[model samples]
Target: MWFKHLIFYRFTQPFTLTADELEEKLTAKCFKPCGSQDISTYGWVPPLGRHGDMLTHSAGDFIIITARKEEKILPASVIRDALDEKIETIEQEQNRKVASKEKKLLKDDILMTLLPRAFTRHQTISAYIDRQEGWLIVDASSHNKAEELTSCLRDSIGSLPVINPPVKNAPSHFMTQWLSPKAVLPVPFALGDECELREPGDEGGQIKASKQELTAEEITGHLDAGKQVSKLALSWDDALTFVLGDDLVIRKLKFTEVIQDQLDAINAETAAEQFDADFSVMTLTLRKLLTDLINALGGEIDEASRGEYIEKKILEVSKKQQTAEETAQETA
Candidate 1:
């Protein structure tokens, strides 16, 4: 599993659950197929699939959890055709029009009947919790989808101490400055032709430009005339690119050949091995890029704090692994 997107959040308080403790709690919520009568199902699943028993995959200071959502896909056209046929039969037999409520009931019944035969769609959100960093990173592109994963995790563990981290300096303001006349980016970020500019206040003007230099006079005039950038498309060292939003949500990611080429060369014997290699390559590259982006966005963080956090978390993880091994031995 290569992580595609990120929705970053910070923990407001300590999340002290050990790997064994978290695994035990999540086992009850492990994912299962949607039942015949149910339209959907949601639960935790092992990141390594069936190869791993623990629902949470722990690596040093980081633990990853995958949340799967399954939903039945009942076509509207099918339901409408079925409803029309039934309505026609009823009208012919009763020689009368159906009431509104009766029609609604009929539609509901049709949906329930079709649900069992409907195709199923599955979506999984992989979330990584950095124990020492106190961050819960979700590979989710949308806010509602990420919240669904958070909500499910809360239901399982009975607690979640995380919330969206506050952004001090607005991203729009910074992005506009970068695209301004002869602007030099802080470090790695560079302006691309793609940008969504919106006029602030009641006037409500908006426009999007793509594949055109952001430094064009027309674009600068809009910015000079008070249009704020809500979405700034940016690239980094020609290796990675993403749309940076006003809310700091990164979307529409495209990694260059430099990053993808490494993973493409990997030839693993098992699904687990391939997944691990893919994940390691992606995570290592992304983690560094994200750290730089946070700094560029003025999300000030102490380096010493990070070092201390990682060290402490690694020790705790080691202890938990040893204890789990001991428990297995005693059981044997």
Candidate 2:
């Protein structure tokens, strides 16, 4: 509600006024603008006027005197004087309306409905029901008058009630948990060991072996045999550095190397199945490699020292890979 009423003004031409001159003008009664101070300080019905501008009041006060760059210069004082006179005329009309017997209430007019009542020569106060809060909102140009009126209204109502400031907006209640920032957990993916293999010869002669496990030496042999790498495994420390950083990293190591190495080993194995069996088996092996890698990287991360390390390492490796890829592409 406050944001809606917040006003900002940008002058077409910058104003030139000395600090002393500005202060002097602000102090003058004739230069004072309605609602120049706190708008809500008065009451629900704050005095209305332009938020910020060079203007005049009928008392002949120059509201704002600042330099203008225009060739045909307009004195702010002169414009203010004219506007002030016009405002006086308008005030007279408003007074007449207030006095008119035929005037209709601009707001709720139910008999005995709480409405502003003159508290003193300079002050008027009122109370309104705040249905949302089940309370009453008081308004008055003078805080003293508002307080007095609040007491009188309560007495008239014959019930003990909470007195509150004017309600410009609805009551708000926030759930504490809702206001808390959410922690986004990293997405989970199955590790190489978890990947299931199709039966041997499922893809004709494309694959041969369908085993789920492969030793480190066997993995290296596959790489030597020129098979495409699909998965790889690493020690816990290596996995931690790859996924969570040496300081903060969190991505699992690629299983491509492991798969490739395994393929080579399978080729070298004397028990290697038929060409079709070999291809089929390698495909399943690749899947297992990926599953294992994921599992290794997904281990619980040390939140303190290890957190920052992992983050830094992950970033470094990612940057290096990206750079290498770019270089290769450029060469091509």
Runs in model 2 lying further than 4 Å from the true structure: 1-122, 141-143, 163-332
Candidate 1 ranges beyond 4 A from true positions: 50-53, 201-203, 237-239, 256-274, 300-332
lDDT for each residue of candidate 2 in 210-324, tens digit (9 for 90 to 100): 2334323343344334332222212331112122111111224333454445456654433323332333443343234333433333433333644455556557646966997
TM-scores of the models, in the order given: 0.79, 0.15
**Overall local distance difference test of candidate 2:** 0.30
Kindly state the number of residue pairs that clash in model 1: 0
Candidate 1 residue-wise lDDT, 210-251, digit = tens: 888888999999998889999988888677888888877888
Top-lDDT candidate index? 1
TM-score for candidate 1, please give it. 0.79
Model 1, poorest ten-residue lDDT window? 300-309
Clashes of 2: 56
| Clash count of each predicted structure | 0, 56
